[model samples]
Target: MNKTNSTKKTSKVGIVGGGVAGSTIALRLAEIGVEVVLFEEGASLVNGPPICHLHAGGNLYREISDQQCVDLLKQSIDTLRVFPHTANIRPTVIAVPKRDKGEPDALLSRLELLRNTYHSLIESDANNKVLGEPSDYFKLYDQDTLIELASRDFPSTPSSLDDWMIPVAKNLNLDEFKYPLVLVQEYGLSVFRIAATASLALSQMSHCKVLTTAKVNHLEQCESTSQWNVHYQQFDSTLGDWVTGYEHVDYLINACGYKTGTLDNLAKLPRERMVEFKAAYVTHWEHSQGTWPEVIFHGERGTPNGMAQLTPYPDGYFQLHGMTEDITLFPKGLVSSTAANAQPELSAPFIKKLTQHWQQDEVDLRSARAINHMAQFIPEFSSATIGGKPLFGAQQIPGTDPSLRAVDISFDGINYARTEIVKASSALSAADAVVDKLQKLQLITNDQHTSLELSFPITRSLTLEQVENFAEQLAEQRHYPSALARRVAF
Candidate 1:
């Protein structure tokens, strides 16, 4: 366990939910000499949808505005600085399919802009050079170069940019894509590793108490002391019933992802928000060359020709996401809150898929569709089979705009802040906003504490082997293949 700081504790904070946002906030607060009580309904933390891509430059989504892309780039760098072990350090391949109306050259301006932004970040702080040299932020490959690389065999280990592109050059059907295919520095993030890291870190924090299998039942503001009384029911298997308890906290932070409205309704705060249900399939392919860069065949989203993504994992396991309505998206998958209720109501089928086991037939059918979708680009992937159950969940977008990727903390009262993060990378920004709010309210004092400035006590102390073992155990506990926890090194 990480030792408590010599600084005196100031105030108590109550946080609901144990997703990335909650976990990040709890650790930051506890590390800065604040008492935190984190409540998680699930047995573990960060057990939501599978997060594979870092979106270092938001290159995958061309529809979002340039500002959102830059914001994502900054947040992604901060995330890597905090959880360096969770990164799968490989570039991503993006190609425009022949059938798609988009052109490859149109992306050049944005790539150049991203490269400049990265250079500026590095100039400010040399440590910000996490994604590698700004000069190598992205590289373009002509058809002739790809053809030449295709003739060479896959190397045992990849050392250069060309080395990483070998599998893509050999496997991808060049005729189907436009020339000048681009390779960006965007990498992959292992959700299992993040869960393990958060669990270990929270356990060691001296002022942080993580209560798993505990659900918040009620919240009441104390008129006398101005503290909030948090009532919760923790399941006790021995008694076969839920045991009720309460905690008093000077401030409250709602970090629930999709269920943020539950706490909002309890506080009688009205807000406009939308929730989206999405999933990505996992497949195993016996590829002679084990490692491959994340491949993207960009097409319009929700249409028949939607984007198809193939994310590589260890042990020949790959995760796939087809953005078509029939694949990762479903009918009525995206819903918004009605004026009567702040909580958006997902269909019963989606709720069942989220809370219970997915039907095996549906999984097989969807997995097959994803396979066929990728096989169109890489024929060898046609033989891949389902590796595990789908990684599915409902994510909350702060506003009604589904295209909005950037979000932060919103204050409801003097002591209450609600975080609505669209992507996992935005968690740190949300936490920083809460920290700033705490200081403004005089709930905590310490102007010098920053995520970048202060060292992460738990993650810094853990070894790679310990993280791998714990991540594998988390994967098994969550009914996923253990290979998902292993790092992909080539």
Candidate 2:
């Protein structure tokens, strides 16, 4: 490690992990002239677990509380304002399957609550109306209306809700689900776009140093200076060996996603958290030529018949997630940190999938199961074949509860904060919480341009065309179809 004392005084914040949590904080802090150093073990940022849906209203997860859904709505709006280019601008369809105990009417109260909350947010700030008009935040269509829509032709570009619903009505087995299919303004979020945008923006920022493909080996706090020394190693291509280095900063943030507990263990801060390993499989439906909204068939999680999600991508690609033990979730996927070690250790098989390559047979098996899960509702979807490798990774949920969705930053001390974001949309709120902490510590001023303005200097420097190009490039680089970087309808 380089023990250079020259740059110690200027280093303000050091972030470990280049996931959305760490990337958002680095971008937000750097926007206000704060010096930041972000470390990512991966080659790129925001390459963690797949973040397909924006979760604008948390309608997908029926187990979560109404308050959590409301919080998700607000946080998702904040995310949209900052990264407008990432929004897919397509609505989501939430349906209760006949096999499930949930009634469609039971969801009406929560949808109404979300709509009212959305209206209130828009009333407070007109800019919060990114998910379309507040009045159209959600729409309900009875079985009869859907049956009528099935007879209509699917448009190439959907101009109205009925046009978007036509594909769902034609493809989906309406008899298998209850009446009143709810279409919400919840949009899709492109993880590739976020990765491209954050990587580009951070590269251009003078005050922020983005260290990709660098692994943090150790962390030590200086007793006298009250600063953190983040020790990391990067591979030197010329030397064909790893080079070690360290950065000293006044504040530290452990945004390591599932591995956050590793730093807490190193700091000897025994914190309670859970890590879950989840995967979403990609499939290509050649027969489906029309644009379809994101479809959700509600079922009890962890059961044989679990919630099946079919998220559409451009060019016949769709991501499927079956919330059963043998599919997207595993037998011991959710693990809690022990008292001795804050880092909850996943089994070798799960770790292998995360760090190393997943076995071809396992991918094929799980993906087939996911396809069948979706085929339960859309019988024609049984023919869909595997499109690409599964988007898989582990995520850190702050508490022991696996269902917790809404979370922000939690501070261990005045200078140390840990990000525990369950959903990607919560990343901006976690970043704002870090900013608030900095303000409280008198490190960053109150008037330091903290607002999430659409015209931020760094984001404004790039156009939507540039974002599209970079996002497609990232998707291709990651071995995924470039079409996955695009919106379904728009």
Candidate 3:
């Protein structure tokens, strides 16, 4: 139960949907002294999966391409330290499975070519003096280094059928892999990390209220007062049941992900086009097993929306994502030209397609396909049981209860953003953009009374590698934050 800030009680903003966008906005607004009330329809910030690459929970990569904030990803990654609920940075390995025709993937080929180029750059003293290590953020390992690193860091059962990719695939349980893995030093976007951190921040931030299990139903603006009346419902304890209530908010931000259309969506903002897809989360599959990087089986270009991705949590368990989005085929996944109108079997096929290479007979062939694909990387998956059945779905963002009355806050005073609702990273990026827009609109203002900003700047030429090495030295000597990063696995 958070109380509004008495000191900064002048401006109160209401945000609907406590997903990535809403949570980030709430934190930013609270920092700037705007009273925030974040309403989330879901009980938790990182809702249960059936997750996707639009899986927003973790990465704070600065090269978000859109330049929403050149440093937002860096700032977002920093939250792993500022907040207690998240995991620190870990070296992410991207293994591209071998392609057909006895050749490496064109993308991987280019990546290897780039690595050679970077090696040349590092070796060139003139270039180092000129470019200053543009490859500082990554640790691009060659075939032998990747194999040795994987074998040392994540030791699992070596595969039997290893030839060319043998060096990189030596210790990894995956029978499928590419040589010279791409090791990203600061790559990862974890949903659980964002959920825990954001929820904790919302709980602790002054003048902020995070209302879970609350659904917005109606929105009406008071033209005279310039405030919006927000009507929402929630299960109230004192009332002994569900109750409807209203709050008068100075600014209303619709950060609702997929449910934006249920209300009168904001004009001029990009519209998020969501499609139904199927995916799975397996907990028991690598129960108390070895660590693995975020493994993505590369699909055709720009087809992650319909591809397979395996992501690991801080706990070492993994979520395997696949999509059954072939709309022309009936029952969804079975896109056979002849069986177009076949019976819809649901998630079994999506999971199967995800785990196609590995073989499992326990669940029907339709379902086992997905599980088997996962078993290649996670051998325990072959023996492990499913935690929960996979389901066909779309964005995991809070959905409007069809039974409840609907609201359209984007009428007059309220504002909304309609960018594609992918993962939590995009949400935070979107929030930054929204905050920028609000700053221009005079809806957001910095606090005059807040504590003075940190003005210290260090004068040093220590490279990023040096700083990281120093951190590692400190981590070894004083092992505290290391638990959040290195010792995270049980």
- Candidate with best TM-score: 1
Which regions of candidate 2 deviate over 4 angstroms?
Answer: 1-11, 448-450
Each model's lDDT comes to 0.87, 0.87, 0.44
Per-residue accuracy of model 3 over 184-271 as CA lDDT, tens digit each: 4333444444554555556666668888888888878776776778889987767778888878787677766544544333222333
Arrange candidates by TM-score, highest first: which order?
1, 2, 3
lDDT order, best first, reads 2, 1, 3
Q: How would you encode candidate 1's per-residue C-alpha lDDT over 305-360 as one tens digit per residue?
A: 89999999988999999999889988889999878888899989998988788999
Query: What TM-score fits each model?
Result: 0.97, 0.96, 0.61
Q: How far out, in Å, is residue 340 in model 3?
A: 29
Give the range of the ten consecutive residues with the poorest summed lDDT in model 2: 1-10
Deviation from truth (RMSD, Å), model 1: 1.8
Candidate 3, residue 449: Cα displacement in angstroms equals 13
Pairs in clash, predicted candidate 1:
none
- Tens digits of lDDT, candidate 2, 281-388: 989999886888899889999998999898999889999999999899999998999888888889999999998889999999999999999998899999999999
For all the candidates, what are their Cα RMSDs to the real structure? 1.8, 3.6, 11.5
